[model samples]
Target: MPIEHAMNTISERHRADILIIGGGAAGLLAALAARRKARERSIVDSDFRIVVLERNARPGAKIRISGGGKCNVTHDGAVGEMLVQGFFRKSEQRFLRPALYAFTNDDLRRMLRKRSVPTAVRDDGKVFPVSGRACDVLAAIEAELRDASVDVVTGTRVRSCLRQNGVFCIHTKMSDFFSSRLVLATGGVSYRHTGTTGDGLHIAASFGHDLVPSSPSLAPFFLRHPVAAALSGVALRDVQLSFRTPSETVSRKGDVLLTHKGLSGPACFSLSRDAADLMRRESGGEALVNFFPDFSAEDMQEMLLRHASAHGKQLIRKFLQLQSAIPSGMIPLVLKQAAIEGDIGWGSLTKNARCRLQRTLQSFSFGEVKAIPLDAGEVSAGGIALGQVNAKTMESRICRDLFLCGEILDYAGEVGGFNLQAAFSTGWLAGSSSASGSAGTGV
Candidate 1:
């Protein structure tokens, strides 16, 4: 959507006690929490009004597309387990503990149940709606907004935000809105089509908040080798992915998909953020796949030697097909990589040739990774610096009456439902804290 200066010149002004920018999962939760907190402190029924401003035509675009439209609501686990399992930094895990404890995954399930959206936890610990529709999850939030009487403005992109005399004037393409308390849950730079284009980061930076440089997370890597491209669409279970850089090497084991460009899947995603960071600083790095993760090099050599002895008279190609657990299509590729002739007989195979075959089967190199596109990622790392925002309240330490939540902060989690859980917990804290602070002391 293009910003129109002419429209802003004649745009009408609306006022509210609390203003939330963005109508994503975090924004929706904040709006509800703020309303609830305000009512709790108020002596009168209509004490303060809360409003949500969304740039998109509708809210929760990200939610509707999450988990392949099923909407993984959150991960099912204890707070400590979630923090450690998803590979979140120790410092960030500690910072998020209060919010995670305050609004547990059980609390979220209960809240959704009250909204008529029953949820089920998957075997892998991912929580999803029983209906298997992300729209239902979004509908629940919309219902809460209506019940709380929160004003929602859609199709209005914020042009600028100015703070003067303790009031924030948010200028949009359609109009100008005023409020003392402002909550920014606009998300990160990824998924620009969903209205998370790093606007909040830019606006926050303009207001004197330092920004950590943004990069893509949870995205497939593009490799320098043609092997991944040739094996596109082939999937392997129980494989280990190793990312090797000059400084360090990281490995993860899970299911992986070979794409036209490179690698993707849960295992690859676990290494994406660190891979992106390394690829950004250095031009490239090596990615090696342990196709036979269950067996060591010595174990593989022993197994291969036994199989060769049993099928000494057979062709090497036929012997590998009959004795190996690898996929039929992958065997030819592996043989080619090992520089072994498929037509060669097992009886004629030399000791050195057999050793080469065993090593290649154990670990296949995918060459170097070239790049990871920032926009193609599921989440974007780097946003508002963590130190500038209070993890307890999600309020800005540098500015008054301002709260930050969701991907706008410099934190990213591994794929699954960790990111969504973080959004909900942080949003809950920011909303209630903003309302209580405004009503008691008046920011």
Candidate 2:
């Protein structure tokens, strides 16, 4: 399957029992779940039509490129753990709970497994197809669509969504559609290249939903520190990164990659949302990188003292190189930042110098950090507020028969497989609930 697009010609007018906007992960899963629910109610025999309107030429553009083309499908963990991760706001968690519990990560893997897509979970619990090909995952979903008779409309950007006389009319460049139930899974304003250009936000707002004010969620931070620029390509494993704002401090731990511009990788991306959000409010924020997060400054100082007592004649640089996990290339930078002479022997090291070295090794600072942009993130945060949507069904309280889910909602997860799982879960709920209703007609 070489990224097949629905290159079929658009129809002038279409009618469906359920019309789902966006053919991304959420939309596709919603369609599947909707049809499943419809069949269980004997609604399929009634000539029920389900359509997925995709703006791009093909479906799952983001999925094809996610996890470096491997597609981290979901995080492997207990459902309780995933819920307590604080990915969604406390108020919004109530709304997300039902969908997440209803369709767990194991459920997702089981669905893929049935389609011949074997998955493996990493040590950190991130799940990806063993084939390491995102297309396989997409192909599996596409197969399900074909099996369920989902009418996928591609290369058709939706122009407007309006409800009149209890029927939702969706206008697209390709055609116009009328349906009793309409689902907005158009995703958030990130990855514009993948066709997620914040279209869902405006559509949801038009239906009387309030937005949460969007920003980049799992993005990298641009450091103003010159050393970080020079240390580009240096990777630190299990490092802890903490950001300090005037109001509060937030931190995350994972592998960090020093990029030419700033910091990236799991640790940085996990904390990027808070950093970016803080920067938006005001300035004067700093990131403290705990080189040895497990060790306290006092602990390091005591260890160094014992080492100095044993190898008093050795050079400070050599002593650190031998006793610590800090890389050889990082030693010079650390010594310089600590204002300690690199050539100084451990025996000659003063008490003041010992404390300084311990502090530097414990917490190195990136003076000021600025995030790239919301679009640079894997998923955009903020969308239709959770208060207006039903958690059990994903249906809109403001408007009848209109549903919203995925990144189009205010919930944004961290850099694991959390975001994708959220999308799939919400989409399933929305689609199932949307299709379970009686088919309505226009005025």
The alpha-carbon RMSD values of the candidates against the true structure, listed in the order shown, are 3.8, 5.1
Candidate 2 lDDT tens digits, 1-443: 11111112224238777899999889999999888988988775347888999988999898899998989989988876776673746765667789998788998999899999999999978899999999999999999999998999889999888776677778887666777789999999987888988888888888888999998888888777645456888887788898888787889888888888778888888888887778788775887778788887778788889988998889988876874457677888789879999898989999999888888877777668855578889988888988899899899999988888888998888777888899999999999898775743431
What TM-score, over all chains together, does every model reach? 0.92, 0.92
Each prediction's whole-model lDDT (CA): 0.83, 0.83
**lDDT value for candidate 2?**
0.83
Q: Candidate 1 residues 1-443, lDDT tens each? A: 22233333432336667889998888888888888888888624355778899999998899999999999989988988998986468877877888788678898899899999999998999999999999999998899889998889999888789787677778887667777789999998988989998889888988999998999888887887655346788876788888888887777888778888888888888878888888777767888778788898888889888978887888878866764446577778778878999998878899999998887776777788877788989889899998999988989998988999888888898887888888888888888888884442322
Q: How many residue pairs clash in all the candidates, one count each? A: 0, 0
| Model 1 pairs whose backbones collide | none
